[model samples]
Each structure stands twice: as structure tokens, then as C-alpha cells.
Target: MSYHNPVLLQESIDALAIKEDGVYVDVTFGGGGHSREILKRLGPNGRLFAFDQDPDALENEIEDERFTLIPENFRFISRFLRFHRIKKVDGILADLGVSSHQFDEAERGFSIRFDGDLDMRMNQKSKVSAKEIINSYSEEKLAEILFLYGELRNSRNIAKTIVESREGERIETSFQLKQVLQKYLPKAKEHKILAQIFQAVRIEVNEELDVLREFLQQMPNLLKEEGRLSVISYHSLEDRLVKRFIRTGLFSGEPEKDVFGNSDVPLQKVGKLIVPTPQEIKINNRARSAKLRIATLKV
Candidate 1:
């Protein structure tokens, strides 16, 4: 039940440029660490809404009158906020990627160190588990996941091997999948390779990238005139999307320019990328890959 320290806590919250009376959001309210900090800086009139798809996160809900926890994925930020009779917020903070608690819990199947079921669904209620993907996906489909999600160079061969191995029996757990591809995991790079493979499967199971895009698309409409968007991404893919969206307001391609060579964008970058310091990383290793990007509505 312990949800260890959050990564890049102070830096991410500072990037929000929180206002005493303005409404805010913590889109990834896993351990409630960032949410708690936001509350500490808010005034009596300020309101905060947080989101988490995982049922486990409900346990960590903050108990402040000004704070409300939404037990759902952040991808539905706009829909859920509207349901609560809210349209605009002063600032939005998203700490993307998996929570440390997810990795520590062996049964969650988010860690390679443990022998657990292949159930990497952030929402335990989700029907599509990692087991289903590894056992049912065709070689071509599996290869695509490994190559695109995992960034594996020998994805085709890896997929073929998985297909061949799983044919004899169902791949029911993390350890089983590891054993099937034991040949690829050498002592020198075992952890790195296994992590990449697990990351690909987890991302696919949760539809992380698609959900991210959907959430980002809603930011412009959800924010107030001077509202801020503070996001922390754990990998290059998510960071790229945030960086691009902030710069040009699109995931791919350049923004259109007018006769004066001025282009319109929903949000403008607040500052350079913010990362955790050595002291913070030493305290929480997960902070190593964290990248915080802050942006505000374009004038």
C-alpha cells in the first residue's frame, strides 16, 4: 500500500506557476504527492481536480474540501471536467507514465524483477491484458509493437520467436515471456532489454500514446485565457509529443503561417525542460527519466 516518493516533485509543481485563487488539476493523481503540494499553495476559494484510472489510486485521494479526485483516466479530462459542471481551469499538471507503486507491486506485472501475471493494464478492470497481447497477437502485429513501442532493432526475429514459442502453450506470466526470449537477454543487457519489452507491452495494453494525444487535444479548450499546462513525460515519445504540441500546437507537421509569417498555436512554451537534480534522483531513481515541460495559452 506504500506509494513511495514522487519524481521531480518541487520542479514540476513550480513549473505550474500556481495562483492562490485559480483552479488547478493533477491529471495523474497516483500517490497524491503533487496534488498535496498544489493544495498547500492554494487559497480557500481555489479548487483542484485530479484523475487516475487505476482503482488503486483511489486509496490515495486527498481529503481537502477544495480537492476532488476523479477515478478515471486523464485521457477523459475534458469529458469528466464538464460532467462536474466545469469548463475552464487556471492550470493543468500531468505527471505522465507509470507510477512507482505500480512497479513495486509484484502482482501488477509492471516490473521484470518479479514473477507475476501479465496484467499490465493501468486500470485493472481493463479487458486487454499483456497476457492476451503476447499470446494472441500475430508475428507481424507483435513485431510492429516491439519495433514501434519498444524500439527494438530485432523486433521481427523477436516476434517470430514469441509466436513460435507461444504456439506450444499460453504465455501466462512475465517470467514465462522472459524465458521464451531468453536468447535475446544476455547478462550484459538483460535488464535493459526486458524493460523495453515490458514497456512496449504496457504501453500497448494501456494505449498510452493514443490517450496522451486525446488529452493534449483537449488542453486548449479546457484552459482559461492565461491557464498553464505542466506535463512530465518519462520517455522520448511522450516528451516529443508534448514538445511538439507546445511549439506548434500539432503532434506532427508545422503550424500554418499568415502573411506576416505569424502562426497560431494553442499554447506557448513557458521555459526550457525541467529535470530532477542529482539529490532528487538519488532519493528516487524514477526521477532519472522524468522530463517536465511547462506551457501557457497563446495570446
Candidate 2:
């Protein structure tokens, strides 16, 4: 059970400002760490609905009548909640980014330290694995993904190298891919660069950005009046989406003003952005990039 250490654990739960009997949702129940904390904060009658598309997470399901674990993706939050006869929840928590367990498990192919199959799907059944992305994507498309998702400046060259190497034989495993691009990874920055490269491939394989957008769009309808959304994102791309959506209700540009001359965003920021304390990060190195953003439905 070497799952994630739930970065900013107490802070995130406090962001929900939990009510004794309010309905809540943990949309990313990876290790069930956050969900277990939520259950502890709830009264006997309170309800918690958790979601995780990964089959591995199902083993950690909480044993309680008040808790329901939904074995599905959080992008389909609204639909699944409806099936459970829940229209509006008092609070929703999402911990974005890959779980620690995924990184630790070599076979999952989510870590740069491990040599494994290039299969980085969050859901095991996903059709597009990292192997397919590396082997099949056009150089231009690969460059785009690398630049946009990994923030790599030399994406064109990297993608070119991958394409050239794959022509001889499929880049089927993590080690094979690494060996192909070994020249690009100088000893000084090898780990950082490889992590970025793997990040780009993983994001595409899981359709993470698209999933985040879809889940955010459903928030206005899924939450009760004054309900809260407490999201913990591990990268700038995701943090920006949550921040922008909370501020303007749109991912890009500005939302039109309402009759009262105010922005029509459905959610308003609850407080300043929260990040892990140095002590917390010391305890869990993964918390280094973690950013927590809290918001509530507009009054």
C-alpha cells in the first residue's frame, strides 16, 4: 500500500470547510488517502462519493456504509453522481497528477527512474499507451506535444531524433526510448529532461488536459450553491486551468459581463493559492510542485 502521501493533506481537507453532514466528493481517490481523511471529518449521516478510473485503486476502497467508491473517471463526474441520485454536492476535491504508486510501480511506466513497458495509461484498458505515441506520432505532432505538455524547448530536435530512431525498430520500452535519445540527455540535466519527456508522453496517453477541462466545465452544475472545489494540481498547465476557470469561468480570453457589470464566472476564489510548506515538502518530495486552489460557487 505504498500509495501517495496526500500532499497538503490537512490544508486540502480544511479547504473544503467540511460540514458535519454535507455531501462531499473526492474525485481523484488514488490511494484513498484523501477520501479516508474526508470520512474522518464526516458525521455518521454524511456521505462521500469517491472516483478513480484505475482498477488498482479499487483495492483501497473504504469499508463504510456512508462511503461509495465509483470505479470510473472523474471527467464523468456529473453523469456518475446522477446515477447515484446525487444532484449537487457540498464540496469536491481533486488531486491532479499521477499518483505516487504509479511512479513506484515499474511496470506502470510512469517514472523516469524505471525501465518498463512504455505503457503510461492511468486506466489499464486505455487504447493509446506511451509506446504508441512514441512509435506512431508524426515528428511535427510529437514536437507539439513535447513543447506544449513538457515545456521542452528543443522539442523539434527531440522529436526528430525519436522518429529517426524508431524507423530502425519500434521504441517499445522505456529503456529503449531512453537509449535512442541518450545523446540529448547530458549527465547534468538528464533526469530533469527525461522527466519532462516522459511527462509529455504520459499526459497525451491519458488525455489529462482534455479530462481536466471536461471536469471543470461540469463543476458549476455539479456543486450546490456556495459549494466548494478544492483542487491540488502538480503542474503549471493544470494549475493555470483551475485558476483561470475560477477567475473568469473560461480557459482562454475573458467571459462576457452579466447585467450587473460583473464577470459571469460561476465560481469565485476562496483564498490565495496554497502550496506546501517547506517542512511538508521535506516529508514528501512530490509536494514540491503541488499547488492547491480553492473556490466556491458564486453567490
User: Pick by lDDT: which candidate is best?
Assistant: 2
Q: Which tens-of-lDDT digit does each residue in 1-299 have in candidate 1?
A: 25857777788888878899989999999989999999999999999999998888899887899999998989999889999999899999999968888998989999999999999999989999999999999999999999999999999999999999988999998899999999999999999999999999999999999999999999899999888999999999899999999998998899999999999888999888888899888877888898999999987
> Where in model 2 is the C-alpha error above 4 Å?
258-260
**Any residue pairs clashing in model 2, and if so which?**
none
Clashes of each: 0, 0
For every candidate in turn, the CA RMSD to the true structure comes to 1.0, 1.0
Query: In candidate 2, residue 49 scores what lDDT?
Result: 98
lDDT of 2: 0.93
**Global fold similarity of model 1 (TM-score):** 0.98
lDDT of 2 by residue, 267-288 (tens): 9999999999999889889999
For all candidates in order, the CA lDDT equals 0.91, 0.93
Q: What TM-score fits each model?
A: 0.98, 0.98
What's the CA error at residue 12 for candidate 1, in Å?
A: 1.0
